[model samples]
Target: MRALQSDGAAVVHRDERAEGFVLLSPQFKQRWRFVTAHMGNLHAVLDLAKVADTLLFVLDPLDGWDSTGDYYLSCLFAQGLPSYALAVLGVPDLPQKKQADAKKKLGKAIEKRFPDAKLFPLNTEQESLLLLRHLAAQKQRHLAFRDRRAYLLAHNAEFVPSRDSDLVGNLKVSGYVRGWTLNVNSLVHIVGHGDFQMSQVDAPPDPFTLNPRVAKGQQKKGQDMEIQVSICPHSQQSASVLMQPRKQQPLQSEVIPDPMEGEQTWPTEEELKDAEGSLKKRRKVLKVPKGTSNYQAAWIVDDGEDGSEEEEEDDNMEDEDLMEEASQVVESSEEEELAEEECETMTIAESARDDLYDEKVDEDEEQMLEKYRQERLDQMFPDEVDTPRNLPARVRFQKYRGLKSFRTSPWDPKENLPRDYARIFQFQDFSRTRKHVFRQLEKEETEGAMVGWYVTLHICSVPISVMESFRQGMPMVLFSLLPHEQKMSVLNFVVRRHLGNSDTVKAKEELIFHCGFRRFRASPLYSQHSSADKHKLEHFLRPDAALVATVYAPIAFPPASVLLFKQRSNGMHDLIATGSLLSVDPDRIIIKRLVLSGHPFKIFSKTAVVRYMFFNREDVLWFKPVELRTKWGRRGHITEPLGTHGHMKCHFDGQLKSQDTVLLNLYKRVFPKWTYDPHVPEPVPWARNEQQLFMQELEME
Candidate 1:
């Protein structure tokens, strides 16, 4: 009902004795941030829940628990906090028998949701002290699960031009390290940027503290810290280099000869004249008479009888035979030369033909061909458009239906029923069960409230670089099959791949598939609903359905080398989903891909005012540490205390002006730390992890 403003600090509310009586124990002092129910802002509640060590759910005996109260309770449960306490008010004045019965009924309701919560009476001072004691004891255990200790390795770095003439010799850098343990002495390796000797690490003091005190020891490990490092830029490259694909080189045999070789050759004038004379002389063609017969006559040789004559004739014959052998060898050499020339000509022809076939069609020719095809179709069906055959005869042309607004209709209890109405349980009270299950949501809503909500799921076994991005607060969304419509189809595809070509039937009906933080278990049992239940579930399968089943599967950190990170110039890491294995089981298939789509904008500095693109004052709180990058690749961070009208002050390595364009990157990197691994084999239903230990204990009771 009251609000107070504090200068240079967050507003704090203090209750006076007249307004509300307070009881303080000497042993411990408690600080509370009161959040009212009528505010209707769930984000504020969630933010407060993150900082609260323990949660208290207050219930009035007379009012009992209504839809609004259930909604708040569900928000608290969604946080998955370690400690919870329930306080039932207005029970002290009731009769002993009635009080006992009320306590038993309330206990049953609370146990169903928070099995491990401690119960107490609101009017009892002793019980309040006990709740505080329990919360203090569990604080350390919860902190261990929430805190992640990791270091940030620099992904990109650049030198900032010095503004002051005195600091000309020194080089300044406005880059960030994505991990913790960064100090003045920390030697950071920047890819594509040399490892400079850091002279000073200038970091802004914590802004939350009203009167900040200088820390004597090393700085604490937390979210990404923007620090300006003054260093002497190294002239030589660093040992660490960004990974890149290797360039392919041509092989020796595949290399082509130089074109200049053929051009450099020249024939002498004497050789050219001889070649011309041979062409002029041409072939010695033997001319035949007009009346000569076409067929050639065969000649036969006769044998000689005289012995002396025979010896002389044999010598002449040997000389003639040797001359004939020499002529044959010359002719074979000429034929080989001709064959080589023919092969060269054929190769040239083939290359020319290939070039002609591969040529692209002219734009004019393409248009002409399309026109011809359309004309031919038009001639075949002259009135096709007027006499459409696909549409129903009753369908009205140019008339629009309100199908787009169908989901906005008011809730009708009778019209909307559960999926399995035909197979209703004999003893089950459907209305009571619905109220109990959907206590956190509005009464009119029938589907799950948290179905489409996006949360960053930690992945284990990711590459060291990707892990650095995670540590820096990059949100990696866990896309589960429960939120998707085509989950059954994808499951079938995976099963078929796993079975290969074998026609053997799978013995088991149920199969579990895990990707990132999502764990999906599908079986025939899930589909075993009554006819009415099937109808209800089928409604959810529609494209416009608002409700979905609540998925409570365990999630864990992704493994190394499983995800890829690409650091953009605006200081946002774009997740490369390609080559990412979505599921290790079912033959390690890669199905869906995701990218971190951060909001981007341009800003500039004017006379004592910072100008930004399309952001209101309310949006400033959501996007902290708004990253700024200049056109020249210089980086900077916007300091707290944003100005009015989408304007905010920024800190950069160098000087800037109104005309200079600065890009802004805004994204949520901090995510809830999950404590359980969903991929562990043969996990007991109740004995999953320490978080579930209390639930298991309660289930046994």
Candidate 2:
């Protein structure tokens, strides 16, 4: 029903009574009549022979007929219905497990019967609609064919002509030549096109193996496809009786030819010999002895009778032919010989190439050996020797000296020392021009606080304790003068602020060199303190403020000491400094006083072999210091007038028998400023003990 509706077929009632019978009957109806009163009980049992090309069977599940579906189908096949003719329709109450089995059985039964039926399994209403749709299609094709608008082509013995279709119009058929045979209901079947599946099927004849009559008929039919108009030849002569059309039906069985008729007769050896003897006799008859009467057979040489002029021309060219054949043979032989010679030459060349390759390899190995030998010689006796083990390189580190007073000093015009201190303190002037917001403080007080700020010296990290101490004096306060709503505070280290203030006094008075600082907007103790010390001060400082300071940031320092150098030629020791001069003026640096003092005590007695000197004002602090030494030079010298003025170079060439003794003596005498104070308690006694214990365990282990 769905398919019919999709194809646009109309539904109409022609036999109302018969339709009711079909709906009520338990058996499937075989046929339908136009008269409504001529209805009969639809017997579900099928008669294969009576079934038409279009068989419509409608079954109903609600009527309670079940389990015998396969049996019912068997009856349809038994009566000779074509497989494709039958249509089974129903809402059969078939169990899921049994459905497959039932379908298989029904399919087998149908296939056994007609083998080409188009079986449709559908419900009652569906079967009725499908049949109607098929009938309507037939009517349409019939009208089209009647109008000569469509051509019908039939295939096989079941010859139903193709109802006209615009899609496949006027097609020429070629394969196998024979036209289709169709039944009245338009069902088609091929007569000889009944080829079975290769497996489990009888082998089909090869293309050449033909049923002779059928083959001839097919050929004739193919030729008939090409229509020819006959033209009469002008023939007044009467035609012969031998040329009549064939009317005899060809016999379809095998026929034996006459060639094998004497196969049953056996020949004796003598008879076989006689047959051979007859051939010998014929040869002997052809041979004529030279002197015999039959000897000069005229047939042997009748040139004029047997030979044409073309034969004489061929005979004249025979010498040239012999010459050409001889040349061709010679060329072929020469080619073969040349190929053999090439092969022998290639073998000899390859052998020579191998020899040259071996020689090159041997030369390379010799070169490598020579290089290895030279390297070994170089290792045994180096070009230059290093200094004796007892002597240490001459190098020195010393303190700097500076002006005695905190006030600005005059610069020497001759030496280029500034007459006005501004030149020396250019950065300080620049520092004053910078802007800073002093929150909630008088202008005079803010100005006074901006005097001389101090910075902590550190190699790397800032000391936390020092920073914390500085933070205690700096408290948070609202900056009313500022436009930004953020809160800020300023530490009043008066000297760093202006000239001097009470807060500055409260801060440590001494310029604590090497005191590191980490800047923080909030207190370092606040939750906002970052773990890193080198972060931009802007993180902690306001944009308006030029500088911020934190004194307790961690500091890293290398172990450095002021050491004297002894000139290799001299045996004098010099004292580099007097006090623990954290910083010094350049003039006060005792460069001459610096000397190398080793184990045997280079200073025989005290003529003051080493003495410190306090020079005229010239010094450097953290910002101004000398550059350190280079690895290759005898010693480094500072040309700058910064703290570098104190640099000294001394070398020790005197043999130091014991290095440890020399180091101890040098350390004690040269850097007298370095000492361990027993009065000051050790900060980490446990750490010291643990280190000792670790060393002991390492030794034992």
Among the numbered candidates, top lDDT falls to: 1
> What TM-score quantifies how close candidate 2 is to the native fold?
0.14
- Residue 469 miss distance in model 2 (angstroms): 99
| Tens digit of per-residue lDDT, candidate 2, span 295-383 | 22321222233333542343333334444554475478669978975664212245445644543242465575565455554445322
Collision count for each candidate, in order: 26, 69
Give the top-scoring candidate (TM-score).
Answer: 1
The TM-scores, one per candidate, come to: 0.24, 0.14
Measured on C-alpha atoms, candidate 1 has an lDDT of: 0.32
User: What is the overall TM-score of model 1 with all chains considered together?
Assistant: 0.24
lDDT digits (tens) for residues 1-701 of candidate 1? 11111111122223331122112222343322333322143323433344334556677664457654554454344333445567776787887778877878787777777687667664654555565555445552242212221122111222333445322233322222211223332222221111222344333221122222333443346421122212323314332221211321111111233445335458899989999999778633344434322221000011221233432332333333433443475478669978975664212245444644654544565575565556555556331232122443124221211111122423233332222221111213423443453353233332211221111111212224333332433221111111111111111111111111111112122333332222334321111122221111111111222211111122122120111122222332222111112111111111111111112222223112233332334333323223456555555544332333333444455555545555543211111111222221222111113323432343234
Cα deviation of 196, candidate 1, in Å: 25
